[model samples]
Target: MQCPRCHNLMVEQSFEDLRDDTGSLCFKGWRCITCGEVLDPLILSNRAAHREPMSGRARQKRSFIQIGS
Candidate 1:
C-alpha cells in the first residue's frame, strides 16, 4: 500500500491494543516507511466521514514530532 501522507511505500503491521473497549486485542494496519504514518480501518473510516473538499490553494505541510526520537 501507498502512504497517503508521504506517497511512500507502506507495509502492513500488527498492533496490539491492550485497553480497547471493542475487545479485539490485535489488529492490522499500514505504516509508512518514510513519514511513519499509521492508518488503520477505524481511522480511515473516520477520516472519510469528515473529509472536506480540497481547495485550489496549496497548503503547507506541518512538522510532526517523532514519538521515540
Candidate 2:
C-alpha cells in the first residue's frame, strides 16, 4: 500500500496495545517506511468520518501580542 502523507511504500506490521480496554492486545496495521506513519482500521474510519472539504480561501496571518517584553 502507498502512504497518504508521504506517498511512500507501506508495510504491514503488528501493534500491541498494553492498556486496551476492549480486551484485544494485538492488532494489525500498516506503517509507512519513509514517514513512520501508522494507520489502523479504527484510525482510518475515524479520519474518514471527520474529513472536511477544502475551501479556496487563503489563510489569514495572526498577530502575536507580547506581554512584559
lDDT of each: 0.80, 0.81
Summarize candidate 2's per-residue lDDT along 26-58 as a digit string, tens digits.
889999999999999889999889865454222
lDDT (0-100) at residue 39 of candidate 2? 98
TM-score of 1: 0.63
Going through the candidates in the order shown, the clash numbers are 0, 0
For residues 1-69, what per-residue lDDT tens digits would candidate 1 score against the true structure?
Answer: 999888999999998887757675888999998999999988989988976655422222222234334
Model 2 TM-score, 2 decimals: 0.64
lDDT of 2: 0.81
